[model samples]
Target: MATLMAVMVFGGAAALALYALAATVLPQASRIAAVLRGQSGNVRFEPLSSLVRAERRIAVRRWAAGSTMTAAALRPREAA
Candidate 1:
């Protein structure tokens, strides 16, 4: 009976601790994974800097008219 009680207590405590940690971390983990996968829309991080930067370091420009824009415009506005 004592052994059974100890096992139950230990199991319950372990389960509770696991649940608490998951509840705290799962949302952040999912968000980070989503950002890494380029699936997040807003790219917002609460109470801190955004996961995505204001300016992208690399950009791919598509020419719909089969003509490229001037290098001045193609470069970032700040770079120009």
Candidate 2:
């Protein structure tokens, strides 16, 4: 029981420390991101729809190519 209590206390302290660290760091991260966005002339943050669409298209093409290759490999070859 004592060991379990000690573990709980230490784990709680560690979690609190991590929370404090993120609280201090996130604002700085956001500021840096805003600066980069400003320099790139993008006034607003856009959703990732276009990027996701492009990735899906690439993935579909790769799947089709792989399926074609596997089908060809499994086909019986004629003997000469």
Alpha-carbon local distance difference test for all models:
0.69, 0.84
C-alpha-based local distance difference test score of model 1: 0.69
Worst lDDT run of 10 residues, candidate 1, spans 51-60
TM-score of each model, paired residue for residue: 0.41, 0.37
TM-score of 1: 0.41
Candidate number of the best TM-score: 1
Clash counts for the predictions, in order: 0, 0
Q: For candidate 1, write residues 41-78 as lDDT tens digits.
A: 56454543332332221222233432656677667665
| List of clashing residue pairs for candidate 1 | none
Off by over 4 Å in 2: 30-80
